[model samples]
Target: MRCLWLLGGSYLAAVDSARLDLSQVAKDPTPLCHEDIVDETCELLSAGRNVFQRGPSGKARVLSFGELQGALHTTLDSLASYMDFIDLDPHRAGPFMVNCMELCSLTVASLPLTHRPPAPDVACYTSDAGVVCDIDVSDASFSNISFDTANADGTNKFEHSTAVKVTVEMGNDTVWSPDVAPVDPEDRDDMPENVGLDQLRISVANLFRIFPPFELEVTESKNLDDVSDPQIVEENGTDAREVEVAIEVSPTHSPTDIVGSGDELELDLSDHEQDDAAVGAGTGEVASKRKRRASTDGEDSPTKRSSGSVTEAAVTAAELRSLLGEHLREIKMAWGDIQDRVTAVEKVTQGHKKELKVVHGKTKVLDQQMTAVKAKGDATARKAEDLETKLEGLTSKIEELGIKNQATGDGSDPWGEYLARRKEGQPGRSEGGEERKSLSEEDQRSLILGGWLADTKRSIIESEAQQILDMPALANFVDTNRVVVFGPRKSFGILRFKIRDGETAAGVKARMWEVVNHVRQNKQTLSSTTGLGDEGRPMWASFLKTPEARKKSAMCSMTRRVAMRLAAGVKTKEGAYYNEDATTVAGYDVDWSTGTVWSGTHKLASASHRKDISRNDDYQALKLGWVDIRAVVAVTGCDWSEAHEAFQHEQ
Candidate 1:
């Protein structure tokens, strides 16, 4: 049987007979010579002198078709068993794909036939149609062939019908069974003789359960004897009747020039065994034991040999046994030495393991120490942060004291000056030493406000005041020095000053107009607003245009807008509205009748306006009432002191 393995895909079925290119075989006629085929097959099949003779020395011999079939079947079974050891069930693994193409190639290449083309010589993939396998061995033919189809000793019909059929055609004559359906060969005529047999065919069905069973009958017989082996039909375990299927010659042999058997080959072992027996004369028992060992292993002993070749093989087997025993002794001695070394190594390893345990203990102790240090470092870091915060606070206090000390002279005081004037019976003094009469608090406030007009550049007392009063005369009030001032209204008393050198009612009216204009302009732009009730005027229009307030030039409306901005906060129980900075009172009131804008009622200033100014260093100073002109004068007095020193040096 010449089995063509179907791997990867159904290539054997996919490729048609027309697509096969057998031209190379036709052109060459003999791809491998008879001698080359014999040499190649020697490694796999049993070899005999007749099977491997040189050219023209003797008749050429070939392996019978039954032997080839048995070799291929046995090889396949061995490979399947090997795959099982590796847990690869070939049946379940599906068709041999490209992944196993290498394994398939090796298996095919290892077959004992030179005329057989290796798998790599043919294309395995679909992209290329490769050379077809055409094994022809009609030239190296064996004359002596036997057919065995005896049914097994069973009454089972399946076993009775399961048989292997072999046929040979010799020059236009079928020497085996003719074209016929299923029949017992026992009932047929004897196999034909006196025919020059050249081509031999063997087919097996149901040899194994995996392959589908099939059979073939004798078809046409031709005079030409150059038929190559056909692809093996798959075995599909069934009892179907046989038919006339195509057949071919094997690749391992040539035409019918000889007849031989490859079973009687044996190795000669007598010389080595005799030498061992002479060397160990007293070891007759050992020799007998070896002979018994060979027998137990299913090998024929010297006494059991039936032929000269078998006797020679038995002697060679005895020599091998003696050599193997010597090797075993040496191996035992080497293994004992290895065990001693292993024991010493184990002792060293145990000592190392104990030292490692000690080192691990030390490592754990170091880790604990590191953790302790880390905890201490964390506590120290927290302490350092606390110290940093305290230091920052102290630094801020020092800086505040420095700025205050730099601004205010040590001995110069505005309150002290007022006290000195009162003690001297001089309520107000002129530069010419005239004893001025004491003025009302309202008049004093007007004087202070008037002084602020000249000092507006040096102070921010009215910085939040909006330019609401747009009267031209009010714009010139600063130049005229005709404003009044009132502020720093403590719970016990109020402060007032006057700078009465211009028309007080006109300055007041101009300021009122400015306030009304600011409210009218910024009714929507300001953050919030209140106290300006509906005076029958549009929100965008000047409140002074209302019929009732027009008489006062909208002075009442302007006053209300000012009061609303100043008192923009939640009112306290004392009727005071505190600003967002809870310590700062919202605002104070203005007594326009006396031209006095008083603010001391809530310790605040009744500035004409107070916009929602952003908190910045300069504006914050003004908001905190730290921009008093007295403080400005005291800080700036050192400039005059330096000038006096310069003048003295000039003198």
Candidate 2:
């Protein structure tokens, strides 16, 4: 009665033939990804901005679907060179049909500052077959295996951010339950080592996140109890069960080979996860595209039909080809929609600008009017205050006279009579007999300050927002490191850094992969998926997978898709090689040269000294990967001002 463990997607079900339970697993969606065509909204904003920037002479470039297609081509071409694989599209269709995967090669190459994570962090295998990646791991995206750089005595391993939720069930020898933790195995001790023997059978279902860019949502959890349930059988098979073991994914990290408790490990077949036998041969004359079918004509082709008997209405190869084309066409339509939205956004932006001007003018007028009104109010308040004081004094005097009158007669003498009597009697009376004014009860205390009034203890307002960026901690790391920017694929920004001596340039390149791997795109977080109508309501951002829910694909290491580069030098010692940095910090010039990689919003977070690289105690390289860096670390001990001045004018 030994226990086994499983993670990510449906590996356990595919590999295990054992009867087991899977009751508590769940998938939660987070808005990690989305895709839209370059529409009017995107067009107007992206296109109009360039025109606005140029002011007069520059042509206002409208982004076409073709142009976008071209951009994708450009990006993919650059991306493929690093992966060293060819794109697979027999018909040379659109990228949508190709299922463009997140570029994890770049992320892996530059992260952890030394060792890179394997590719295939997140993926969607469809009805059609293919690997998410179409390239080879380059020096830009890969690192030489370091035997002694890691701190661990055992083998060093890293998992991509892709994950799945699992419940640790009770076994004769195990504790299996559900817990969601963002920490990667490389970042922490992943599964408890002493928990179980391989004899225990584990089971769970794979939940898909309906969103993209690596989000996951749990769909259903199956247990031994569900075999009798209709939904379980309807979902394909209730015959198999979950078995804990390893599953293999392809180069770009989509699940491929699955292993089990016994020898039953095999991958779950999706619409696209193909059988090895059906795959078109990897490298041959068959992959080449013919120019005859390639047409510059914009018209779409109609689907052809096949001839069979009862199912004679069944689809033919020609029809399948056409259907594929239509699918590609649908992808194109999505792209067009994106473009249209772009244009619409542009118009909205222009309208907003005009409205903004009008609003500004109104604001100015209001300010002036308010100033005058405030002055008038102050004058009125002062006048009223004076009047109030006068009234108070008069009231006090009147009260004194009333008191004297009351004392003078039982019926209370008239005011005129009291004064007459006062004059007669008081004229003879000394100063001691003269009446002094007393405050009226009405004026004893301000009504606003009474117990019945509202109570609001107002604190003095502070003048500014406190800085949340940890300045002291940032100073600590920057003082020792330099920065570089490189990628297995290109979109990395101008990286800013200060590097220490002895670190290799490749080491920096590998380390850069670590940072971009975890970039949280705003598309999901920008809006609440489960919309709230008004205030005081539950709010959630759109995502394919939530923090608790996971989308596991064995070793789904999309972390490699993000690329990074660090600044360092290459030096040769004897017959071996050495990578080193020129100085303690590489600043402005480093940023200038790589402005496209790190110059903008990206930050080098989660920096880890590759303890695995120091396994045998070699310190030349760090484990290059991303580990949840809580803050942005800068290159310290450099003349930043001077560096900026020198590179400010550079393009």
What TM-score would candidate 1 get against the native?
A: 0.17
- Candidate 2 lDDT over 416-515, as tens digits, reads 6657867787532224653434322222210110011112111100000001112343343222222111211121112222233565545443333332
> Could you give candidate 1's per-residue lDDT for residues 1-651 as a string of tens digits?
122212100101111221225575456553222344333332222222222322354432232222232333223434344344344445332232111222222333333343234211232211113322432212111111111111132123224233344344433433332222334545443222111111111111001101111111213222112222122112322111111223221222111111111111111122223222111111111111111112222333223333443112112312322333333333233333444465579779999999999999999999999999999998997676566546655664464445334556576555677788888887643335543334422332222211122223211332212232234533543323221122221111111122334546556545444534544555422111223453222223221122222223233223333334333434557865443322222333444322222344321221233423452222112211221222111222223333233223322
Q: After superposition, how far is residue 76 of candidate 2 from its true place, in Å?
A: 18
In lDDT terms, which candidate is top?
1
Worst 10 residues of 2 by lDDT: 198-207
- Model 2, C-alpha of 152: deviation from truth (Å): 57
The RMSD (Cα, Å) of candidate 1 is 31.6
* lDDT over C-alpha atoms for residue 283 of model 1: 14
Off by over 4 Å in 2: 1-108, 111-248, 251-334, 346-433, 436-651
Worst 10 contiguous positions by lDDT, candidate 1: 201-210
